[model samples]
Structures are given as structure tokens and as C-alpha cells.
Target: MNYIASITSQGQLTIPKPIRDKYSLHNRAKAIIKDTGTIIEIRPLPHRDILSLMGILHDNPVVKANRGKPSQQIIDEESAAFEKAITDNVVKEMGLPPRKK
Candidate 1:
């Protein structure tokens, strides 16, 4: 599983095609480069899209659904609170003026 690669004058290295194919790496994939005392290691970033993220957490068994039904008023209040938290986080990240129109 070893191959020779050269570092270019611009400080870029070409990871050989065979190694790339074996590791399922694609163009522009992010990697963590570690410089241990004796060796250099490159690790790929985790898959980040929703489906891949869900797959990582899919092993847990589902529990029985909730049995006690809450009153509609309580449910509406809780839903509104959750939505407000999400909206606030989004706005903070974007740093846009409060929604207009």
C-alpha cells in the first residue's frame, strides 16, 4: 500500500491515483494532516451531508412512541419555543438585519 509521491516547488503533493481510488477520495476532499514525531498521516474528513450523518446514528433501536397525549395548548407553546430558538440561531449565524417585508 505504499507509493512514491513528490512535493512540488509550490508545496503541493500529488497523491497517486491508485491510493486515491483505494481510499475513495475525491477532488477537493478535506483531510487532516498530522505530523507525528516520526511519521506524517493524512485522514479524510467525515461525510457531512444529512443522509450520511443519519446513517452514522442509525444503529440505535427505536423505542415505543409516546403514549400520553398532551393538551393542544401545551403542544402549540412548545412548538413555538422550538421554532424561535432555531430562527434565532439562523439569524445570528447569517448576521443579516432582522427579517423585513
Candidate 2:
């Protein structure tokens, strides 16, 4: 899954479509790009609590619809999903089976 892409004059690198599709990276998705001494690593940032608050502040329709403090059940479900996503990515990177998203 190696790809070579050119950086634009504006200094923005376009991630390949296959990688974006595989990671479910939508428009304006957040990612962390780190210089890891020997190599560079790019990791997508999952939508978290703070991002949810930001969404609410910006009047995101979905966030606005679910306004107010979340219940324990909802919180638990989101946590579970986030954990599963991380686990799935790790397994995939290790060339394991059963991709779950």
C-alpha cells in the first residue's frame, strides 16, 4: 500500500483515494502528521468529545439535534465504537483478517 504523491505549490499533500476510502476519511477530516525520526507517520484523528462540543458550538445539525448532556448508554456505545475502530486499524496494519468498521 505504498503511494507516491506530489505536494502542491501551497504545500498540501493529497492523500491517495484508496487510503482515504479505507480509513473512511471524509472531507476536512483531522489527522496527525509526525516526523518519527526514521520515517513520517500519519494517523487520522477520531471524532471525540471535544470535537462534539465544537460541532455543537458551530450548530452542526446532528449535534444540535442531540444537544444536552449525553446519557451513560450513549457514551458507552461511542467508546465501544472508538475502541473497535482502533483495534481494527491495528489488525489491518498487521495483515490480520476480518476487517471491522
Candidate 2 lDDT for residue 18:
95
How many residue pairs of model 2 clash at the backbone?
0
lDDT top scorer: 2
TM-score of each: 0.46, 0.49
Model 1: pairs clashing at backbone N, Cα or C within 3 Å: none
RMSD of 1: 15.1
Q: Which parts of model 1 have CA positions greater than 4 angstroms off?
A: 49-101
lDDT of 1 by residue, 44-78 (tens): 77556555566553454321222244567567766
lDDT of each: 0.73, 0.81
Model 2: lDDT of residue 69: 49
Q: On residues 19-47, what C-alpha lDDT tens digit does candidate 2 reach at each position?
A: 99988778988898999899989998885
Tell me the spans in candidate 2 whose CA falls farther than 4 Å from its real position: 53-101
